[model samples]
Target: MTAATDGTRVTIIGVGPGDNGFLTLKGKQAIEEADLVAGFQTVLNVVIPFAKNAELCPMAYRDQEEVLDYAVGQVKEGKSLVVCAWGDLNVSAKELLDRVRRRVDHVDLVPGISSVQIAMSRSGISLEDVVFITLHRRDGKESALEELVYYLKDGRRNIILLPSPYDLMPAGIAAGVIEDGVPGDHRMTVYQRLTHDDEQSWSGSVSECAAITTDFSDLSIMI
Candidate 1:
């Protein structure tokens, strides 16, 4: 019988930039020994090779509820599990992890390199020079947009964008800033899937840049 039959340690793992290479040694070890791989199946697909013996959890929205429930159930049964995510330690991750923690006395956050940090590093921008807004809220907020516009107008601030998978990305954002009267030629960089082999980048401005029709499914944009 495998680890599932006897049960073992269950965790929510961070896969880091959708790259197996970015996975930490410990994280890889846990995944390899996990009884079940539970997470957004997109991320699951990306890291399947790492979880040689684990069962893949179906990709489901509101996976938090089911994933949390399953992990707790596994721990009770003594079977190990590892749930994956982009950053398994952020706010969204925290809220989800809290649910399982409430039920089980044991759980640990396995950290991974955040795509945001990777993008910032790749862009060569300091955290001090950037204003970050994670637009992935239930209710969107553009208040940051105003300040971003002002900063762009000043021509000195580097803007770091954590755009919601919902609203404007770097290209759209640049377009809006330009429409608001900021310099249309302001340089922008969109690091889609940073730290991954498929990672792509583009540089241009609101006034002259072409449409960005690429996959921003898991991405970070900098300007």
Candidate 2:
């Protein structure tokens, strides 16, 4: 255990796309030796085995500021801690970590397998054959989906989307495509929990998927 004033308050470790094995060796080591491990419930479950009697602090949706505050406080209190995240923490936790980074002098970010990387691997979709988009924003930005449809219809492009929780799901995307007047049933894939815990996949037309469940705790979409 060291103190944050020595440099940084938190060591952010990326557990890799829902699967612990995909986590970096350095990340595993950090968690194993950490005095405190903080993350969401899912990340906590996977890291628990390696945490050396570390206290856990689980953050729920959008509670990142609180988590970071606690982490910085702990570091000030001289506790060695590793903050867990999905796939590269820097990539997924960007919004908040950026703010936290300005407040702290040091943060160790560990990289891991990204969902897009895994989605490509699982679908055997050529890395060179697709465009990736993130539709998880609160604003129902149909512009992105509209543009994707344009490319898909041009028959010259393929897209992989990271859908927003329930507000902007694959089904809803399909609806958007139709609303945008893009016809023809496009093939789609949904990989739920990408790398762990009842991971599932469904390959079908975009229309059929609209009615399916959209509980994307950790998942991806391919179109």
Candidate 3:
């Protein structure tokens, strides 16, 4: 395959919501063709089989800069690579890729089923009729609730991407909505570890959910 200047090319592959079955054919092909496969440990594990011949570089969310540096070094060495990501790479890897792109000129991205789509599908809700918001990268304690309230006030169904923050979880989201004038009886669902074999989902009213103190996984989704 052709490469950019200095021979570094990056292919960002969306591995889907923590399930190997969700990986697209194109994504798999990219992995098989790459010389390096890099991403979070969980995603790296899921894609390891396809990257049998490629070097695997595992990194955590906080290690994004380090991972990008390593990837750039490999690309400069003329290695073809595929970077795995949970859900759609564009969703969680936006900030990471944004920085990497400034260094690596040739980049390609393959889309996969995002957790947002899977949550909406499992809930049997039409995305066209819902308001979508993501607190995944934002400081939830800041404007997350305010923006949520604005949409919640519209009365349209909402599909929110919650961050793993103390005050923006399913319970906290419910409490915020209830305090924003929505009735406690409003219905919503919390989908945990979405799309995985052990995935679990809970449905309840806002008030009922507010009483829950059980912590959810980092992959949980609320709708």
Candidate 4:
């Protein structure tokens, strides 16, 4: 369904990594003004305080379509809707943005800070010297893994990667890169729960990371 022609708009706002403090001013204003807000429960929780005036619509992967459709219907009724996403929309949230765009004709995006930026600051890497790849999407991970390997082999730029939580996590990604001819001794750092109080980071050779058995948080990035 398309957005209502009476100027009602659906906005997709990035809530910024896991920390609400990182939320941008524009993003905060959008959420605060929304009539209906929808997002994964975790993301919604981060923006709950700012979305005080809106009806909360928490959704999971299995029911995201239904929830988004409901938000669109609300927009049709002349109410403003905001769909929250974790991190910056330009980074790992393209899939979510694509889904939102498919259901609404006029969707405004408000970008927020991404964990990748946090990782960069923590690792002292410049954005121009880094290539980012996220395996966080629902599908097409094999090619993403290949792209990671390809970049790793290039050896000119550092990589900031968001691995798939289900598989291809830090260890799996390290192993895959090593198997694909990137040196096992290449330095790698894994940052977990960035921008949060319990944030943790581990830095070691690719082989060491591949051998790691310790469970890492789902909110993790590798550099």
Candidate 5:
């Protein structure tokens, strides 16, 4: 299906975690070809160099819907568009992708490396032994928490989880899992700003992570 009534395409490109070098070649090409580009300010910053020819539309949580609506209008006017997201679209940007799909007939996706992949690589964990979960959505915290508890109790596979930034950050997630009967002594590591030059990490028992007082960067994942 074509993206809009005018037959222009709408592509959603995952720009990788933080570093521009991680962006896939196809993603760069899409950005270079876009008539308009839209995404969160941080994501836009990562792709700005490739999008010199495209109109950049940066949005925050408060204005994302409005910004996307404007993008959809532009697409209908026959402009090829690209919406940027951090990490692989299938991993954590499904909600954003769905939003675009609701406004257009079809949307193309280009996957990029995720922080989860970087974490697994750094920790030497195989994908076959991990269960990935993201708590970054606007809703369904209860269900996601229940799933995390179930996995913790199962004890068969390691977990790589992306905590919700606004509420359930690293400490909050560690506490919640412990309260739900996941052992406080469970070993965990939190990685922040993966792929960035100043990336950092903390490793400790769940109890120790729960007691952490320092505010973590918004870009962080626990494994």
Candidate 6:
């Protein structure tokens, strides 16, 4: 489906990392002005106060195609839709924006505090010095590992978005890095549920982190 040709538009808003406090004023305003707010329930819940007047469309994490279709339909019908993206809009929002651009006349994205940023803050590292990679539904595990192995070996700090497929949590990723020539004693930190009430941070060597069997929230970040 295509967008309404008569100047109707949709706004893609990044709601920031899983906390309402992190929502930008502009993002909150966009949500309040929207006729329809579409995103994962966890993300949308953070902005519920602003979106109370808007029609809420809850999407599952695995339903990107369905959510895109819903947003496209709403936009084509002349509704002002605000699609909420987790983290920075440029991250998970890329695929949706690519498809929407082909069907819509105009779309704008509001930046948010990515977990990478929060993780960096928690670790006291400069964002300019970290190589960022997201394994969160980008490609297969093997490909993600290869990318991590390639980048982590550069001697620069890295911020990686861990994929929760099966058992590929921080521990697993650390193990993979260790096997790929990153020293077991290499320092690393894992941030879980950043900006949330139950947030936690773990700091240790790669091997020390690998030995941890505890599970973390799906929103965990490693640095």
Candidate with the greatest TM-score versus the true structure: 5
lDDT of every model, 2 decimals: 0.69, 0.73, 0.79, 0.88, 0.90, 0.78
Q: What's the CA RMSD of model 5 in angstroms? A: 1.9
Per-prediction TM-score: 0.77, 0.84, 0.90, 0.93, 0.94, 0.87
Candidate ranking under lDDT, highest first, comes to 5, 4, 3, 6, 2, 1
Off by over 4 Å in 3: 1-7, 139-141, 165-167
lDDT per residue (tens digit) for residues 131-167 in model 6: 6676766457577778788777777566556556446
Better of 4 and 5 by lDDT: 5
| Residue 45 of model 6, lDDT score | 85
- In the range 1-223, model 5's lDDT, one tens digit per residue, is 5334445458999999989999999999999999999999999999999888999999998999999999889988888889999988888787899888888877789999988889999899999999988898988878988999999899999999989885889988888888889999999999999999889999999999999988998899899
Better of 2 and 4 by lDDT: 4
Per residue, candidate 1 scores C-alpha lDDT tens digits across 102-155 of 765556678886777787788787878876655554444477677777777776
Question: What local lDDT does model 4 show for residue 16?
Answer: 91
Give the clash count for model 6: 0
lDDT of 3 by residue, 1-223 (tens): 5534534569888889978999999999999999889888987888998898998988886887888788779888878878888888656556656766777777788998788888888888887877767676634445766777777777766656565545467887787788879888877788998878889999889899989988977788877
Count backbone overlaps in model 5.
Answer: 0
Q: Between the candidate structures 4 and 6, which one is better when assessed by lDDT?
A: 4
Would you give me the overall lDDT of model 3? 0.79
- Candidate with maximal lDDT: 5
Q: What is the C-alpha RMSD of each candidate to the true structure, in Å?
A: 5.3, 3.6, 2.7, 2.3, 1.9, 3.0
lDDT of 4 by residue, 40-120 (tens): 998998999998899999999999999989989899888889999988889878888988888876778898998888899
Arrange candidates by TM-score, descending: 5, 4, 3, 6, 2, 1
Question: lDDT for model 2, on a 0 to 1 scale?
Answer: 0.73
Who is ahead in lDDT, 2 or 5? 5
**Stretches of candidate 4 above 4 Å error?**
1-8
lDDT of 2 by residue, 41-145 (tens): 877887787885788888887886787688778887888878777776544357545656776778767776677788889988786998767675545457766
